[model samples]
Target chain A: MPLRHLAPMLAALLALAVQAAPGNGDSGTQPEDRSHLPQLGDPYLPPAARKPAQRPPLAGAALQAQARAKLQQRFAAADTLKTGSISLAQAKAAGLGYVVQHFAEIDRQGSGRVSFEQVVSHQQGAR
Target chain B: MPVSLKRTHSYLLAITLALAACGGGGGGGSTPTQPTQPGNPADRGFSDPLAYSSSGNASLSVANEGAALTHHSLNLGGRVIDYTATAGHLIASHPQTSQPKAAFFYVAYTAKNQDVRTRPVTFFYNGGPGSASVWLHLGSYGPKRLQVGYPATSQPQPFPLVDNQESLLDTSDLVFVDAIGAGLSQAIAPHTNQTFWGVDADAEAFRDFVTRYLAVNQRTASPKFILGESYGGVRSSVLADLLEAAGTRMNGVILLSPILNYYSNCAVYSPGEANCTGFLPTYANTGAHFRLTNPAQTDYAAYAQQMRSYAASTYGPAVASWLGSRLPPSNSLVDQLVGLTGARANLWQANLSLHPNTYQFQLITGTVLGRYDARVTAPQGSALASEGDPSSTFITSSFASTIRSYLTSQLKYTAQTSYAISSNAIQSWNWQHDGQDLPDTLPDLAAALQQNPNLKIMVLHGYNDLATPFHQTELDLARLGNVPGLRIHNYEGGHMMYLDDASRVRTKADLVTFYASALN
Candidate 1:
């Protein structure tokens, strides 16, 4: 068992915690049904009714704005030295759980870090 | 499945061979030991005694002296008659001495009707207690063969045929045998069906087949070889031991994507874990292939070195902890250790455990590149949730069509029924509860190599195969303790190394050189 292999299962565990959050109800359950859902198998999930997430639906512009704001917030929180650009260690500190959880989804290079361009692309994709 | 004429003839041949081998009592062991002579008191000629009344669209041509086909029937304990197909030019006289209750085999020699003294004999069989020797016969080695696409595909029709340019018959004489119930081989009378079904029984039967073939052919002096695939790898290992016990030694043993260990390789109980371990190297390799990890790091040797270090130290602990609880501050030390292995960001984000499926899906989705190799992606699913394997899609599809076509069109052998090209025959296989129990054939193989120093073993693996990871094979071979002059090679392919163009060429070359070396 290598660290590279543990990454996904760890992400899944973190994703499980996010699912347990009350307002994020459908975020966890709905994605499970999505074709892009993780394939760890059905045994991990209990056979109970799943409540959906309760996030507000934002339109194209609003979504883009929200994504940018979130990205900025993450960068600021991760940049302990107050440096404009967030370093790899800075990103890990901001939200190691969140970053590791969504790294593959965001880091298109699969290098496991968010570059400025990658962050911008992610924000645009959300729109 | 309609009974095809060709299949019916092949079945007849199998039944005849089975009956001839298992028929007689104590005295039948006295059959002469000559290379070309027929030893069975009942072996009349090249044609089947149980003739078919119907005529076919294709005509059967009897080639003159050097090219005619010889036929025989062997009884393997079952009353059912089994037949065998052999080239006439290959048969030689039987030896003077014979063992009692030995299994009979048909030998097909190459070298243009040359004496058995001149050419080496290679014994070949496919795995499947129920499978016939068709794949090796038509796909790779047998002289006359059926061709399919280079990578192989299911038959377009029920039957498709092609000419095989890679056949090994040009190099060594081949003897294609059907297990007791497969092909044209069968059991005769008195001996129960149970005699040739189980593990030990099967080994005994094959041992008998080789000894009988050697005695009848009178070529005990020539180099002998055994080539098997999949489960046949297990069979060959056991047979290597059995052959030694029966006083015959093998010069070389060739295993094509062999399954030598079941515990580490085939036990799919822990899907996520099993696949993760198996596919890790493949991912590193794939990443290296696409320059995803680092373009400068091209070869797998360097990749494997990094991965091995990660797996043994930080990677192992990170996965263990993640599966249970958060690691202490020292655990972060493990993460830092992982960072040193390259791909620091990736290792940290994975929190250290990368499931096989996640790696597979991530590689494709993140990189926009698909990994056709299963060995790299096979173990990515949840251990308890996913069905068998995602990789089986390509493997089964590719082998099915080509096998169907080759059997029907080229060999002109058909069955009134459908043959199982591959199956879960070992689904019920249980590991020995005792720690000392042997889970695979490595023990027998090691013993054989130890007893006969001249015996050589060659293992070929597809780097992309997750089914039986090349690493697991490497690990097991190392554990065998007896470090003979063994050669192991990796092809950039899957479990079936021959499916890849590059692998097939390298494999053929390696095998030819191996055989040549063994004989000298």
Candidate 2:
């Protein structure tokens, strides 16, 4: 980032020291009442919440493992994998974006639902 | 401030330079075979996820992939300053479901080493709800602009991007945003275009983007302003009020050739029709500029001013009375209209109520004046109503092509998606908002200004522009009951008047003065 953009980040960090109090309900809370947020269903919503200070996505092996765990927790743990696939709602609740992310890789047959083995393989191949 | 921060800045600059050098093989593009760098920022490289500070909201994840950042130095207003230009995407998700929505493309410029609270950052938008920010980005005062000489000024071609000393960067940072369908911005997955294809939806999206940008950038405490052109001028009024209501306060707004009310500019007069004589003065000014007016006067400003006064006093009333079947044939009024607009005296006398389009065509019969700036004219090329705009003929590809080249060759923002300077979003755009006031943004503007009396507004217009005539805006503002800091300035050129050297210089002076006034 350039210094011109840096000043604000620095200022926010300083402000965050005071403003991020529990009472302020600062944006750190995951999945808050976003219904109240402007431009509902806005395709660009992710960036809307991306303040200067954010925790970037998990990358590499960590990301792969997390994806697998999230899938397993949302699918296999719920026995949805017994049907050899999971629904779109299952994928979303797991914090996985279907069309935009690697959901297609796991859904090997081009079907919306992915087989349990395919999900495992997809995570394994994510290096 | 911190030594570590300084070191990181140097490191980032070094990496940015190296990346730029790696793509230096981009030749002066002539043929497709030697294809120079493309303008898609996505082709640059997938970037590290933008991580918020670990201390606050560390869980927020933003994958603005392919975002490119680079630094450039320019001597603006007699001072050499290094500034950074960034090309990136802003992602959107469903507010309730947190389902990923789409990516909004944008480019931003900021002067290095400055306190932002008092000084401000301006987000710029070009008119067509579907228009890209490229025009103002490379055309006006956005750090770097094109040298494609506009008509009535210089010869065309040799569109090179150079450091614009007139850029507002010396005063404030700038971020040019592409409305959803324009430029590289788009709707993702199941979200579809309809999700953001309307007025309320568009305003909310833009408002969210501004809020998110400020929050993410940690500029929540900084002063913010919006600069919108054309339809974006109307957008600025709604944005000013919406953003402020959404917890983001604006210090000022700059409207360029703003169309405050649609009925005023392009209204069709009929039974119960409001006499929109706003285009009269502009028709006369356009006539004056082209030396088409009969019994023409050499003094342009004086003649325009006189016509403006007559538009409301005599011309407007005459048309309104004619609509009521109460108007009488007035010979001197016809002569004045003929002298001011260069139209045949009989056209004015025979038909007291002149339509905006016919009035435009009659000014230089058979040749239509450009809808953007009447000062321009071309061979009446087509009979198609769709292709009627004459001034738009040059600016369309001129702005898009130059911006693409500048971004690719100069900033190294490359992607597979071709840059679109403008799109047909206007055709599909849902113009309906909460307020059914199509022709007047004054209520919303007044609402905002009333809430923040300290907020200043600078309305700039090119006198020769017939599209969003300056006189119409003058009449519109006149009815808005005592706005404290609203000042309108008229210039010699047409819409996008900054294309002229003199206009650009004068416009910048006014801007510098405005920004300075706000700072104090």
Candidate 3:
């Protein structure tokens, strides 16, 4: 996200925090309250509450599995030609947004192309 | 709440659109083979939703979504005013194609025994490219208001639903319009809610709706006005021009705490020049209100005005000079800034800009100021992040519940579909307008003014609004050159100035005068 948009996004998230609060008992259940719109039917409700931030991080095999799977998915999407690797330009063109930000770090060998394993190693090393 | 939150959604949408586009291939000139389907069945070939096909059935028409009309009387200071409230949807078709698009919802209160041609009608909408019109409908000028005490969280419901003595009904007829996907509004099948989620497309949708409204109600000749708050200001600007170009002349346009140019905003995501010049006055205004800064400056409004002058003459030039040179600004400049904004001298010394978040956080120790209304504050539980604006959180549920109750018992309009206070369509809003990367609707507003020489414009802003600072609006309007018919009003409230009792009454009074003058 652009720095200009960060404040507004934080503001929005904060507003969402309020909207997600439990209702004030009136879920429009009254027989005469036929005009009330139900909260359950609201399409804009947040998909799900975020996982607790303090939860223990995945480690060992579980971490590796998750990291490998994520890298594979991203690499496959970016490497549209099925070349098993992608150039920085390819990654950018593919809209690998945040990944593109770390393209140089991932392609540490400076060969101009990064493999899925390279990305996974980069993630694991960073972690 | 709606405006701020939905903006984040629209930014996400912009990225989504970019990613979606990246997956698509470039041009294909050759047409070698025909598809299985010869043509699109859903294509109406530029026909209005209300227009019948050769084999016509009224029941199947998209525009056949009927209205629920309820008669009501509101006593404003012992003067009983009888009115008819019509709640329903108007199908807004594509401007060029005329294909049925979205069914835009609206609730209009027309005073009894008024001449359709002479009586002024104002269309009101709240900002939140994603928000419903309920804020203005129930929380502001609708005959019924959700009672909220200034600077205090509304008590648990049943929240008081009282007659708004400050309602403009006595002066002009009111029509509250919900943007597509908000409230009961939704896109007709074949077209999704995102169809009308961009700057131009959204304005076009509202233009179509307003025109259709006039035609349907046989009030095309009536004196018309538009009142849009927050992002609605951008809509009103574009919509005004669109309506005028289509020959629907508007008598007036009212913008409340509007952000006219996105590129000049202080919170732009892109790295650029730190342009906090416009926000200085608001920061000072808020600080003064809270008695954190300029405590000796008893008159907050006058102090804010003085700060505007200081910003123009001293602070703005000093920042420009600092940006031009590597040398830090003079100590005197830093002291003046620190004194006015109550921000740390180090913050001003580091960068001549004070972001609203930083100011909101630092204005009062252990108390985070509300972004919408600085007067409202909450305990700073964590230094890392804000829970939400106390102003927004306090009244949202109260207003939402009250509107739903009013709709059900008073307006007699009900539906199985929830009246979405806001939509997620902002998650995919197309921000491109006039072939530009970002929208700047001042040109559109100026064009409208040029087109209709008699068109009157009123801008209302609050002193403590951090989202769209009142000074920013002043700067934007100054760029419009000399506009004789344009009027600006500032009050002691925030973005929704009507949330404050005194500001609400003052705003209504000003609006009443505006309507009378515009009609004349």
Give the number of the best model, judged by TM-score: 3
- B316-418 in candidate 1: lDDT tens per residue? 5555665454332255554453333223344334334443333334443322111234432232233211233333332333345665553443233343333
Off by over 4 Å in 3: A1-127, B1-63, B95-97, B268-273, B323-327, B382-386
Of 1 and 2, the candidate ranking higher by TM-score = 2
Off by over 4 Å in 2: A1-127, B1-66, B92-101, B267-274, B326-329, B381-386, B435-439
Candidate 2 chain B lowest-lDDT run of ten: B51-60
* List of chain B TM-scores, one per candidate: 0.65, 0.83, 0.85
Each prediction's DockQ against the real complex: 0.01, 0.01, 0.01
**Docking outcome class, model 1:** incorrect
Winner by lDDT between candidate 3 and candidate 1: 3
Task: Give all TM-scores, in the order shown.
Answer: 0.56, 0.68, 0.70
lDDT of 2 by residue, A1-127 (tens): 8775664454334333322323223222221121211111111112222222123223334433443443344356434446756665565554333212466665667777765566445533541
Instruction: Sort every candidate by lDDT, greatest first.
Output: 3, 2, 1
Candidate 1: residue B217 lDDT (0-100): 46
Candidate of highest lDDT: 3
Clashes of each: 85, 20, 6
Q: Residue-wise lDDT of candidate 1 within A1-127, one digit each (tens)?
A: 9876665556656534433333223112222222111111111111121212133223334433543454355456666766554545555554333333445676766554465445444433551
| Candidate number that wins on TM-score, 1 or 3 | 3
- The positional error of residue A13 in candidate 3, measured at the CA in angstroms, is 25
